[model samples]
Target: METEDMNTDRVRHVLTSLMILSFLIFGGLSAIILITDTPLTTSSVSLPFAFLFVSAMTLIVTGQIDERPKLTKKYLRQWILVCVFMVLVAALAFTLA
Candidate 1:
């Protein structure tokens, strides 16, 4: 169906954007850490939080662009659950680190 195709296309676009944004953000942070002589462990600690923040923002923006409100809301809710899991994992990592 055309609606399904449109949803798939939008999801692909969102994923592509998420990947690019993740790379840029993580790459920049790594570079900064390298330059400042910060420990690799610090980056390890921050990585999850960075991903959580980035993905949430990306999803919010993507949801706004979606013409179907119900679908967007559903997607956003799923992403929120994912982000919460990421945060829990991040917290565990932080404690273990």
Candidate 2:
């Protein structure tokens, strides 16, 4: 049980880190866009928003799972999904660019 709790904590930590990274990236990009007055219609402009969306989803999932005990499997599942989402978003961004 202790090990499961530790694993849950680790998962939470990683997701929280990712959320922070997403926020940083989004904020930096948004600042750049605003400073340059870049048009939102550009394909690359969506990348930051996509990352922000993923982080929001991550936050929601983390909050939901925090209320449950012995949900290590669910944590792993959520981690995998979030990773896949970030990868997909990156791939889309590259393809669009």
Candidate 3:
């Protein structure tokens, strides 16, 4: 049915979002670690928030993909929150370190 297809698409979207998140989180962190020989500090805390933003942006982007109604708002708000949190973390990290 059409509903089933839509549901499947939504699931696919969420999965893709998660995959993208992992890339930004694990991959970015690994790269950062390799580049900088330093232990994690508050400065690194915003990294996860950035990852969330990237993943949310990915969902919004990529040529108009279908979104589930329930997830749409959740993801949007999460992105916003992450952005704000990242900003705070970056500031604190720099000052503290």
Per-model CA lDDT versus the true structure: 0.66, 0.76, 0.60
**What digit string (tens of lDDT, one per residue) describes model 1 on residues 1-97?**
7897777577759666875787677677677767888766843646745664766566565656466644765766766676677767777776777
- Supply the global lDDT for candidate 3: 0.60
lDDT sort, best first: 2, 1, 3
Q: Write the per-residue lDDT of candidate 3 for residues 6-69, one digit (tens) a residue.
A: 8756755775767576566857776776688767665564565456555655555322335354
The list of candidate 1 runs beyond 4 A from truth reads 42-44, 48-83, 95-97
lDDT of 2 at 27: 90
Q: Quick one: ranking by TM-score, best first?
A: 2, 1, 3
Predicted model with the maximum lDDT: 2
What CA root-mean-square deviation does each model show from the true structure?
Answer: 6.7, 2.4, 7.0
Model 2 clashing residue pairs (backbone): none
Alpha-carbon lDDT of model 1 = 0.66
The candidate, 2 or 3, that scores higher on TM-score is 2
Report residue 77 deviation for candidate 1 (angstroms): 8.4
Candidate 3's error at 48, in angstroms? 6.1
- List ranges where model 3 is wrong by over 4 Å: 1-22, 44-71
Per-candidate TM-score against the hidden true structure: 0.54, 0.77, 0.38
